[model samples]
Target: MEKTYTVSVFTENSIGMMNRVTIVFTRRHLNIDSITASESEVPGVFRYTIVLRTTRQQVDKVVGQLEKVIDVIKAFVHEENDIVHQEVALYKIRTETLTNGDVEKVIREHHARVLTVDPQFMVIEKTGHVEETQLLFEKLRPYGVLEFARSGRVAVTKPMKELSTYLEEI
Candidate 1:
């Protein structure tokens, strides 16, 4: 099974870190689905939320390689027990395929918001479980989806816990 794994990497914020990280996957021929990196709560540190298709063994190998890179303070694969994860998806739908009633029905059923109504498309913003996000995509298929963008899964361990916290105790 092509399972999805979310890796949280804490590294120094500097040049070539992304390149180095990406090269690991490229060299292995593992095409990443999505990646989002940004400053973390800790200064001089960066956090990357990478979504990729692989098995548990492959994920472990990837994390091992990531930890060896310079400036990588820590790297870990987050399972459901280790973190709370969520993804956000924005879908643009064509107006032609949807009547007002139909749109309302989908919106109510999925808890989605119509962000804008330009003459060309209607933008919807939804945040929730990955399955829920996928459901929106399925529902909007008949409506001619114009474009879509999703933020990579962002995760932090449950209260009183964090990746670092878990590691420190080890």
Candidate 2:
């Protein structure tokens, strides 16, 4: 069965490491749904949060391969329930929509915030699970969304232990 799995890869920041990590998926004929990379809690270490829809066996193999990468300090595969995750989505709605009270109502209902209000467009930002963002997008579509972008999943295990602890242990 195909189910979403979040792969959290911790590594030292280096050039061409992403290419190598992504290539492993390509070689295995897997599709990467989303990928987000940013500095982690530990200084100098970076985290790559990659989302993929595949079976447990495949995800296990992929994580194993990722851990073998020279720069990869650790790699973990987590099911949706195992981690606390969120994605940020930004919607650029037509400024004219702001004239009517409907847009504001929708934003309040969804708990979304207006990041910027420009004459040409008003940017609304929502940070939540995938479904939450999709629901907001659906509601805002009628108002005219000039642009919509959602970032890849960023996740951390639910356990209280920080990744830095694991890094120190190893």
Candidate 3:
């Protein structure tokens, strides 16, 4: 069965590494649902959180192939229950539509923050699971949303051991 899987890839900083890693999945005809890359806890290492909907066997194959890429230090596959994940979404709404107190109520109900306010528009930010962000977008659509963007999934495993800990052991 196909389900969401998070691939945690660790690598040394190097040019073209992302492309190489991504190509592994592409060659297998897999679609990446979302991906976020950032510096890892260790100063020189980087981590990529890649989400995809695939069977366990395919994800395992992808991770194995990712590990073969140059500069790739390690690759891990995690089920949703194994990790804590979040995505950030930003919404721009026209100011005229947010003139009433109801706007504040809506924001409060959604646990979103107004990042900036101008005479013409307001920017609202929300960080949570993807589903929450999508729901907020649906709710705001009726209120004249001018723009919207959601970042890819960013996640860490729930295990007490940190990535840095493993890096240290090496």
lDDT of each: 0.83, 0.94, 0.93
Steric overlap count per candidate: 0, 0, 0
| Regions more than 4 Å wrong, model 2 | none
| Candidate 3 lDDT, 1-170, residue by residue in tens | 99999999999999998898899999999999998999988889999999999999999999989888889988999999999999999999999987788777889999999999999999999999999999999988889999999999999899898887777776
Candidate 1: tens digits of C-alpha lDDT, residues 1-170: 66877788888888899998888888878998888898887768789988887888888999999988988888878666666788899999887656558876887799988888887788999998788999998988877888988787877766575545644764
Candidate 2, residues 1-170: lDDT per residue as tens digits? 99999999999999999998999899899999999999999999999999999999999999999889899999989998999999999999999988879999999999999999988999999999999999999999999999999999988889788887898899
Q: What is candidate 2's TM-score against the reference? A: 0.95
Models ranked on lDDT: 2, 3, 1
Return whichever of 2 and 3 wins on TM-score: 3
By TM-score, the best candidate is: 3
Which is superior by lDDT, 1 or 3? 3
1 against 3, candidate with superior TM-score: 3
